[model samples]
Target chain A: MVEITIISGKGGTGKTSLTAAFAHLASNHVICDLDVDAPDLHLILKPENEYLEEFFSGHEAIIDQNLCSSCGECLERCKYNAIKETPEGLMVDLLACEGCKVCVHFCPVGAIEFPMRRCGQWYLSKTRFGPLVHAQLFPGEENSGLLVSLLRKQARGMAEKENYNLILSDGAPGIGCPVISSLSGTDLAVAVTEPTPSGSHDLERVVNLCEHFKIPVGVIINKFDINLDQVKKIENFCQDHGLSLVGKLPYDHAFTEAMVQAKTITEYQSGDLAEEIGRIWARIEALAQLKKAA
Target chain B: MIIALASGKGGTGKTTVCASLVRIWDKPVQAVDLDVEEPNLALYLKPELSGRLISEMEIPVSDQEKCTACGACSEICQFKAITVLGEYLLTFPEMCHGCGGCLAVCPEGALSLGARELGEVLWGQAGEIDFLMGRLRVGEAMSPPLMRDVKKRLDSSRDVIIDAPPGTSCPAINAVKDADVIVLVTEPTPFGFYDLKLAREAFTPIGKPMGVVMNRTGFGDAGAYDYCRATGLPILLEIPYDRRVAEKYSQGEVIADALPEFRGRFIELAARIRELAAGDLKEVSNG
Candidate 1:
């Protein structure tokens, strides 16, 4: 199976909207939302969750007040500032806890108890396009990369078991841990970006990341008409780097309107924008196929 | 006082707002770009390089000669950064979280702290605005540490404006923490509205008052406005979608710099932010 991840180094460049539109075009594909922190694909796809699983990763120090020495050794030894000396006793701030287990190991009174922290939940859901594996990380929680890896693994497993040929993923913004986890082992990555300076800079960074991982990338310039001069610069950069400029989508209100309606651009309207997206998907497929043939 | 501009969704004009706010404010403001992964504040501000700070983290190195490979060090590692075999041990520096747990638990005193470069901080100046940006090393997973390093440049005497990274995760938290007030910049779309809620939930725990700036006012649905009104989040400013703004931003120009008309809006935003922050300060002093 081939996994094509749509990623933007910067956020709010229409990554999820484009992914949903592609989901409409690519039938029989397992969709995965790797943006566990703030997932929005479900808002568009409206997935009906079929299976839910609690994801437990990392650890948090739970102070046992009963063991109380009030010695404050754990508080002194904690580097994360997770242990706070309350009037009642030493309290652990789970949000600030890094799960380093330093307090648990060095507690002079052995008052610290370590437990596996439940960070978030992942789900296997059914959408109109196909089965989707997505997840949500609770507020003030870490381990985003771990959750993204879990979702991608589940998506790949479902794809193989169901004999689906494609696994399309929507990756989080920025070239951070979660984005790296999503990029791993993917066959092709579509870097959806805009024509702004930050957009061009971030696109190059994400493309460099893909290059570092030896993953082939295709560029999609969203809102390309917003700045044609910047578009020319992006085009030149793609040419210099030998990256494929797979698509250039114009600025359209339909994308946001479609999102408000909880529908993909292809599903919400039948116009030039939809037609352009269709052509963009065709180019991405052709590029992926070309890589396979080579 | 320190104010932060953030949006859970990227490209919602956090950097633009930060640059514009710094330009319009008459005081010497510290414009900190805490989006270490892909910092763009320097791009807009055109800062002149003044200083640099290198941030490093400690990774564990095992001493084979002094050791009985009891696997104690590996056992205590939460990140699985170290693996101990019967005769040997291996360390993955990239996987290390620099927690120093393994060094503490080494029974034979065989594990020692070794330094690894996490990232660096660049401090510069754009006219009167002090610009500080953290840059994470490419392929590095850790960013919060670098963010903390960048924040070391915080001069409390000067007004500070932090441009936080997108997403309501540890990185974003690290950037916006300790700010007196936070300004959430977002467009009026379903995605924006949803992520704005997430951002609110994440920062609400910081116990700081926040307001919203609806960017691209005419571009999307009014979901963001509804969310702000329902949550009682003050609308600090609304920047309508204009091709000129987009064009100027594409050319690495700050909005207030390119369009003098937007300076009044930014000035008003700064005043409102100060007004809100003063109330928070009063409550802090009272309590």
Candidate 2:
């Protein structure tokens, strides 16, 4: 099975919208939302969660006053400063906990419990489109990378069982851990961007990241009409780097309108933008199976 | 004075504002571009390096001839970057977070710390600004260390401005954590509003005070305003959608050159940030 990941170096460049539309176009594909930190794909796919799983990550050290020896050892041992002294005894602020188990190893009376931290939840759900894998990290949780890996594994398993041919993932913005995890096994990555200065700038960053992994990459310039000059610069850049300048989509209010209604532009209008996305998805599929698709 | 150009979301003119700030500074301002994971400040600045490029960390390389393929290295890795399956061993240096947990656990004297170039930290000057940027090596998993290296160049007397990477992830956290004050840059859009909330979550954990600068303001999304009201984060400046601004940035012009009025605004931004950094907001919030 081929995997195509849609990533933007910068966020809010409509990466998820494009991914959702491409998912619609790519039949027999298992869709996964790897942006576990602030996943908004659920806002659009509206996946009907079929199965849910609680992801228990390793723990932040919490002190028990009952077994407490106030030697002030735990307070100094915590590198995250998670342990704090209270009027009665010691307390642990769960959010600040790094789960490094520093205090647990050094606790004199074994007062510190290095229990698993309740970070987030992962889900296997059925969307109108197909089998969707998603996850939600609690507001203050820190294990987004783990959640992403779990979701990706679940999606891969589902795709294999269902005899699907593709795993289309929407990666979180930036060159962070989650993005790295999403790109780990991607066959092709389409870097969605705009014609603005930061857009072109951030596009190069994401493109560089894809290049690092030797992942075949394509560039999609969203709202290319906003600035033709910048578009030219970006096109020239893609050509120079041997990256396929797949398509240059124009600025359209239909995107925002679609988002408000939780619909992909491909679903709402089925017009030029949709047609363009269709072509791009086809190219992506071709790029993934470079020899076979050709 | 420290000027931080941070938008809630990516592609919302954070680097545009930083490029503008650097152009107008006209004096020697130490510009530390801390967006290490995908730093683009160098692209806009086009600055030549007057500094050395050095790798940030030394990864532990296993000498296959020296020892057995014991499972000790795999067991101690908090990152799980190393694993041994049967007679085969898999090592993903990209997954290594540089904790040295594996090296400490290795037996048979098999592991030796070898220089694996993960990324580079360099210092360069752009216009009147002494610029520093951290470029994470391709396939390198860790970025925080490179960002910290760039941040180590800060001179208290220099007018410092940081171009932070987008999102509230580890790289963003590493970029903005040590800033005296964080100036969140956002657009007046629903998407920007949503991600700005994510950025807010990142900032509150550090207990650092932050303000906002609204870019491309003509769009009728008042989510940024609503967010400001709810969180008490003041809106410092708003740059409306201007075609000239786009042209200047496209041609690698400083944002301040296209809109000269922003010089005072940024200078004032510096002052306001210092005031906020003087424990003003912390006192107010905790009071």
| Candidate 2 to truth, TM | 0.82
Q: Cα lDDT of all candidates, in order? A: 0.87, 0.75
Candidate 2 chain B: 10-residue stretch with minimal lDDT:
B278-287
lDDT of 2 at B66: 64
Query: What C-alpha lDDT does candidate 2 achieve relative to the native structure?
Result: 0.75
True contacts kept of each: 0.77, 0.23
Worst 10 residues of 1 chain B by lDDT: B278-287
Model 1, span B195-264: residue lDDT tens: 8999999999899989888888777787778788788788888888887887788889999979999889
Best by DockQ: 1
Model 1 whole-model lDDT (C-alpha atoms): 0.87
DockQ of 1: 0.70
TM-score quality measure for candidate 1: 0.96
Which candidate gets the maximum lDDT versus the true structure? 1
Candidate 1 deviant stretches above 4 angstroms? B280-287
